[model samples]
Target: MPANTANVVAEYKDPADFYNLINSDEFSNDVGQMLKSFATARTVPGIYETDVSPKEVFTSPVSEIFRIKIHGDQAKETTARAEWENFTKTLNGKKVLSGVSINLEERLFLGIVGWESFEVSRLLNPFHWARKLKFTGSRKIP
Candidate 1:
């Protein structure tokens, strides 16, 4: 989201405008995470290939996903946090701990780091985490 872009999403409702937004590496990464998160939940490949526009966003809700235990002692906190949040919309401590299922069709959270990267494999079992998450609540770890 650009700082100067109109906050009124109704204004620039064109695919070209939305495509320009994809130029940001951050936005692309977020999309990638959303795809992966969708895969994790569905246990299948994703079907969609385009960005969801502001117009279509109101029609559906994204399924939530949680990946846990992803930081090492040497990692920077801000860097790690961005990777985590960028991968998914939900908060870090607010994990899907056994009931965050999606009957819909895809993912909303995504990542190349933090939870979905080397750090998480090093810290937790992917199978256990996947099976364990469902209906989750937030926790203040600090």
Candidate 2:
């Protein structure tokens, strides 16, 4: 196995259980660990501020909007966006994520490094983190 590779096994009875697991602190910590293991360190440290809240527009299938402001390194924005795209692509390959989607919008401020910033907005599906599964005869399935 590769140095950055590991296996995780989770058993959930239903969608709600899967949702709860994703929203749990334990799952967040696991994701953090995976990020630290697989992600490369930036040569220059960047400052970033992020906000996430329920999206006000569409209530039928409740969603969240994620906004981030990044400063110091312009390349960081590109790198961050690429990482997000890769993550979503991976998610799309999973059968559990059928109707989920992520929309990204970006804006760049042209000026001095200290004065300039990169803004990114992501419209997140309500079930972004949840893993939906169907199980039968003790066999786990997605």
Candidate 3:
């Protein structure tokens, strides 16, 4: 079993800042290098033990997906919409779900009210937030 199996989620307050970072040359170059590394590894025989090739894992056409919803004043929303459109155009064939709304329920569900409350809740009932442990195979297979 892999010991480093954790996923991180990033939240950005401003849409333009997010777009700007992703569209920057540094970010683009890093992504390109990662894809190139995957492609290069596919050429090495017996490098990947799995059934799926590196190309299949990295170059899948349906991998890129973005869902963005902006909630703010009319002027801010309009500016964000225009920025999102420009960003999507650069993405080419990627799937993008875009919308603007001011739903209090949705905000309540997604937003973290306070770190203190979050930490206290987790401390009170750790199991409520903990992930279930998964075990595979009775013995190690070399």
Candidate 4:
């Protein structure tokens, strides 16, 4: 594994369970770990922020997915975390996680450096993660 590689997984028991996790320390801990592992040493460039499914965000069958695609050097991790914090802060205590089955996807990138190129693989293991996650309180390490 590369020194800059970092992986993170966010799991919620059920949609209701997600509410609890988001408000609890677990969410913060997970975010913190992601930042700690991926933060870049310097400011990166060519950062692009886009909303994949704009309408689906509020009307999707599954939970909403917020994805960030960045094209830069080592600082991408820190930048990503900052963006994530800003995005999540606007939830306004809404119930964003609720469903019969939840998918807590996790991924680890092994590279020569901390993201030398731009890559987004949220769909890598769609079926696998979707199958492993269920219920309302189980937590798994990624």
RMSD of each: 17.0, 18.4, 19.2, 17.4
Q: What are the per-model numbers of colliding residue pairs?
A: 14, 0, 0, 4
Q: lDDT score of model 3?
A: 0.32
TM, every model: 0.20, 0.23, 0.26, 0.23
Best by TM-score: 3
- Pick the winner on lDDT between candidates 3 and 4: 3
Supply the global lDDT for candidate 1: 0.32
lDDT of 2 at 78: 56
Candidate 4, residues 3-92, lDDT tens digits: the string is: 334433343323566556556786668854656556657422111122221222333222323332222333644554554444344544
Residue clash pairs of candidate 2: none
lDDT of each: 0.32, 0.30, 0.32, 0.32
The alpha-carbon lDDT assigned to residue 98 of candidate 2 equals 12
Model 2 TM-score on a 0 to 1 scale: 0.23
Candidate 4 — worst ten consecutive residues by lDDT sum?
A: 108-117
Distance from true location, Cα of 58 in model 1, Å: 3.9
Q: Return the lDDT, model 3, position 140.
A: 10
Encode model 2's per-residue lDDT on 21-95: one tens digit a residue.
Answer: 657898779875665664566322111222211121222121122223334445745554544445456433321
- Candidate 1 has its poorest 10 consecutive residues by lDDT at 133-142
Please, what are the lDDT tens digits per residue for candidate 1 over residues 69-102?
Answer: 3223224333434544443343354232221112
